[model samples]
Target chain A: MIRTFYGTDTLNSPAAFFIALTIGFFFGLTLERAGFGSSRRLAGIFYFKDMAVLKVMFTALLTAMIGLSFCIGLGVIDPSTEIYFMKTYYGAYIIAGLIFGVGFVMSGWCPGTATVGMASGKLDAVVFLAGSVLGSIFFNELFSIVKPLVTWGQSTQQNMGQEGLAFVYNSLGMSKSAFGFLFTLIAVVCFWGSEYIEQQHSDEIGKTGYFNTPFLRAFSLILMVSAGGLFVLDGSVNAEKHKAVSSSYGLHMSEKALLRDVASAVDHVEPEELADYLSNQDPAVIAVDVRPAKEFNAFHIRGAFNAELPDLPQFVQHHTDKRMIVLYSNGMTHPAQARDSLARMGFRNVYLLTNGLGGFIERCLKPVSLRKEPMPENSIRQINLWRAYFYSFDNARPSVIGSNPSADSAKFSDMPPFLPGFVDADWLAVLMEKPGLKMIDFRDQPEYNTNHISGSYAMSIENFRGVLDGVPSMLMPANVIAARLSLMGIEPVFRFSQKRR
Target chain B: MSSGNQKPYSNPYLAGVFLGVVLLASFLLLGAGLGASSGIARLGAFLSGLILPTHTFSSEYFGAWGEKPLHYYLVFMLLGVFLGGLFSAILSRRVQKSVVEKGNAISSKIRLIYALTGGILVGFASRLAGGCTSGQALTGGALLLTGSLIFLICVFAGGYAAAYFVRRQWHD
Candidate 1:
C-alpha cells in the first residue's frame, strides 16, 4: 500500500507543516494571478459588471471534482478510509452562508482575497484583516450563547447515524461517476452563460467573437469525455469493490434450524472434550481464539489461531466441513455470540468453547485434588494432560491462580500467581541468574539480531506452524515441535515456543 | 486610472484549473482540503493568548487547541499565503498603497470602516460555519460535500441580495 499520512498523527509533524505552507503558497499565487487581489474586481461580480469569480470558482470546482473521481476510480485513494468527510450540519451551514454572502458583498473581499489585497498594500484590506481578528475574538467571547445555533442540526445527524461523507451524489442516491459527469456538463453550461453575460456587458470589440475560441470548445469536450470514462470505469469495477468493502454478513440459515441447534445443545463443546482433542493434537479439530490481540498474546490456548469476529466468516469458508472449528474468548458470551451467528450463516461444524477459556482453565487444567468433587479417572487424566501441555508445568503450579481453586490451602500459597505458560519481565529478570533457563526469542531474525536477551535461541514462529487442510498456521503436531526444539539443543519446554514479541 | 506598467490578469479558466490541481494535490498528500478562516482565527486566538493567557487558554473556543495556538497547519498556511500574495503582487507591479472603493465617491476613511465591518461579519460567520470561502466553498464544494454545496449557493444568493443595499458604496 502506498502509505500517505492518513490514519496517523503525523499531521503536526514539521514535514506536514511545510507541505501545507507550499500548498498555501500556490493557492495564494493562483488567487492573486486571477485578479482576486483587487476588491473592486471582486465586487464587480455582484454588480454584474464582471463574472471572473463565478467562472473561476466553478471551473476550479469541476476540475478538482473530476480529478477526485478519477483518483477514486483508479484506486489511488480509498475515499471511505482516506478522506475526512465533513459532517452535514444543514441549518448552521446555510445560515452561515447567507451571513457570509452579505459580508462578502459589503467587504468586497473574502478572507483569502483580503490577504492578497493586504499584500498589494491596500490600507482598507489591512483594516478588514484587523476587523476579522476582532470578529473572531467576539465570537469566542459569546460562543456559549451561539453554540446552539452553530451546532443546529448536530443532534438529528447523530440520531440518524449518517456518519459517511454526505456527498451531494450520495445524498441524491446517484453514483459518484454519474454525479461527476452531470456536474461537468453543468459547469460547461455555466461557463458558456458567464461568457455570454460578460460579452453582453463588454464593448463592441470585446463582444465581437466571445464564443469563437476553438481551444475552449476543445477543452470542454475533453472534460466531458473524461467524466464519461470515469462513470463507466466506476460502474464496472468500483461498484463490486464497494460491495465487497461493505460485508455481506446477513444470515443464510433458516430461523427454525438455528433455534433447533440452540435447543439441542450441539452448538458447544465441553471443556474436558476440547482438552482431550487439543492434548492429542487432533488434526480434525481447529481452535480459533476470538479475543483481542492483547489478551490473546498475554495467554491463549495453545495451537489456536487468533482471529476477529468480522474475519471469522472468510476464515471459516476456507476450511472443509469435516474439521471441527471451535471459537473461544475469555468468557462464554463472545464465543456463544460467534457460534449463533456462524450457525445462522449455515456453517455446520462451528462450535463454541463451553463457558469459554475460563471453563477450560477451571475444569480441564485445574489440579485433580483442587476440585470440589472427586473427578472420574478419564477426566483426571485429561485434566493432567491439558495442564502439562498448556501450562508447561508438570502439575507443579496452579495454572490460573486468580480463579481461586477450591481449597485455597497454604499448600498452593507459595506458588507464584504468574501464568504458568508465560513469564513476565520480573520473572525473566529473576530467572536470568539461573543456569537452567532456556529463553527462545520468537520474533523475526532482524529484530533478534538488533537486540535480544543474552543466551536466548532465536527461532521464527513460522517454523512451528504448517498448512493443514489448506489453512495456514494450524500448529504442526506436538512431536514435530518437540523435534524442532531438541534440534536447537534445548529440552522441550512448550512455553519456549510461545510468541515473545 | 491604468498604471500602463502592470500586466493583465491571467485567464480565469486557466487560473481556476491551476487552483483545482493545487486542491487535488492537497487531498492526495494531506487527505484534507484548503482553508483561510481557520488560520486567521488561530491567529486571533494566539494574539488573545498573548494579552490574557489564562482566559485564552481556558475559554471553550480557543482552549481546545491548548497553549501555542499558532503552532498549527493553518497558521503556517496563512503565513505562506501572505508571502505568496506579496511575491505575486510585487512581480505583477500591482502593489499600491491606497484604499479600494468607488472612484472619487466614498472617502478612504469611510471605505476603510465599511471594509472593517464587512471583515468582522465574515470572520464571525466563517467561525460559526466552521469554514470560509476557501475551506468550505472551494475545498468542500470540489469534494461535493452536501453542506458545502448548500453553503456555496447561499453565499451567492445572499451576496446578490445584500449587494442592492451596499450598491452605493461600490457604484459611482
Candidate 2:
C-alpha cells in the first residue's frame, strides 16, 4: 500500500524538498498563467466585472475533487487514515475567513499570489509580502490571547466522539462518492451562476463567452460523468482491499517452530505482570480479549478490544515487534490458540495471558482476605491495588467466595444481575439503542405514558417492595431482584440506570 | 511602462485545470497540498533567528520550527514559486517593475499602505485559521471539508461586503 509520506524519513530527505519545489513551480506558473499575478484581475470578482477568481478557484477545486474522488473509488487512496484531514474548529476558522476576506480585497493578493506578484516586479506586492510576514510575527506575539479561539469548537467535536479531524461526509453519514457527486453538481451550478454574473457586468469576460466554448462544455461534461462514476464504486471494496493488503504479511514462522515456542512457554505473560503493564498505561502493550463478543462486552479487562481467533491477524496487523500484544480469554486455551495463529501470521511479540482472565480475577481482583495461606506484604498491597483498579463497582462483590470464578463459570448467576449506577440522559439516550439493554422505568404508568424513554418497561419500585416482616414498603430480598433480572436476560454485566435529573 | 511585448494571459479554465493537475501531483507525491504562508512564516523565523537567536527560538509560533526554520518543504516550495513566477513573467514580457494598484486616482504610496495593511490582516487571519487560501480554501475545499467550504463562502462574502468600503481606493 502506498502510505502517506507523513512520519516517514523520505519526507525529510533533499529529494523530497526538490519534489516540493517542482510542484510549487507549476503552482506558481499556473497562477501567473491565470492572471493571478495581477491585483486588478483578482479584485475584479468583488466589483462584479470579472469573475475569473470564482471561475478559476471553483474549476480548480472541482478538478482536484474529481481526481481525488476517483482515486478513492479506485481503492488507491484511503482518505480516513492516509490523508491528513484538517481538524474542524468552526468558531476560529469562520472568524479567520471573515478577516481573511476583508484583508484579501484590501491587498488584492493572498499568500500564494503575493509571491507571484512580487516575482512579476510588482513593488506593492513586495510591501504586502513584508506586511504579511510582520502579521505572522504579530500573531505569534498574541498567540496566548488567540489560543482560546483556536481551541473553541474542538472540545465539542471531541465530546461527540470525533477524533479531532472529521470529514464532511463522515459527519453527515453520507458516502464519500455520493458527497463528491453532489459537490460537483454544486460547482457546475456555481460556474454557470458566475458566468451569468460576469455576462451581466458586460466586460471582456462577458464578451469572450468562455462558457459557450466547446472545450469547457466537454470539460464540464467529462467532470460530471467522472464524478457520477464514483457512485458505482462502493466503499466496501476499499475495505476488502485493505484486508487483502494486510494479509500479504503471511505466516513468518514454521508450524513446528511456533509449536516449539508455545511448548517452551516463551509466549506466555503472567496475569500479574500484565496487571503491572496496565497500571502504567504502557504504549507498547496492547491487551486483546479473545472472547465471544457477548462475554467481552459484559466484562473484559480495561483497554482490551474483543476479537475472535480469525480477527486476530487484522486486529494486531499494525503492531510491529516493538508492541507487546497480550491476548486473553477465560483460560489459557483460547489465547494460546490465538498466539499460535498470530505467530503464524508473522507477529513475534504476541503473548498469551497466563491463566487468562481467571488468573487475573483469582490473583489480582479477588480480595486478599479469602486466601488459604497468609500473603506477603508486597503481594497483599499489589492485590489490593489491582482490586481497586479492575473491580471498582461500588456494590458488586470483588469476588464470590467459594464459587470458583463465578462470573465466568456461572455467568454471574450467583451474584446480583445488575449494578445500580447513575447514567446521564445523554448516556441513556445512546444506551437505549444498544441490543439486550433492558430499561425498567421506576416511574408510574401515567408519567411513563406521558413521556418515557422509548422501549422502557414501566415498573414502580413499590412493585418490588411489600409489607415484609411487619415493615411497610420494605424492599424485596436481593435474590428476588437477581432472579427477576436473570429472567429478563439482564446479566450481572448489566448496569441498572438511575437517570440524573 | 510598456505593454507592447506582453502576451495575453491563458484561458482561466485551462489555467485552472493545469493548477488542479499540479495540486493532484502534490497530493500523490507529498501526501499534502501546496501552501505559501507557512513557507513565508518560516523564512521570517529563520531571518529573525539570525539577529535574535534566543527570542526567535522561544517564540510560540516560529520557535516550533527550530533554529533552521528554512529546512522545510514549504520553504523550498515558496522559493520555487518565486522562481517559477519570475520565469513566467519574463517569458510573457509582463515583468514591468511597477506598483500594482487600482488606478491613477490613488497615489502609489497610499496604495502600498493599503497593500501592507491588507497583507498584515491576511497573514494574521490565515495563521489563525490554520491555513491560507491555498491550504484551506483550495486544498481543504477539494477534500470537501465542511470547515474549509464554510471558510471559502465567508471569505467571498466578506470580500464583497468590504469592497464597498475600499471602493474609493480602486474607483477609476
Which candidate achieves the best lDDT against the true structure? Answer: 1
TM-score of 2: 0.64
TM-score (C-alpha, index-matched) for candidate 1:
0.65
Candidate 1: DockQ? 0.36
Q: Per-residue lDDT tens digits of candidate 2, residues A157-249?
A: 321223356567766778888888888888777777777777777745426756656776777787789788777675565565455445545
DockQ of 2: 0.30
Q: CA lDDT, every prediction? A: 0.77, 0.76
- Name the weakest run of 10 consecutive residues (lDDT summed) in model 1 chain A: A155-164
Chain A TM-score of candidate 1 vs. true chain A: 0.51
**What local lDDT score does residue A182 receive in model 2, on the 0 to 100 scale?**
85
- Prediction 2 global C-alpha lDDT: 0.76
Candidate 2 — which residues are off by over 4 angstroms?
A7-9, A155-162, A204-207, A235-501
Question: Could you say which candidate leads in DockQ?
Answer: 1
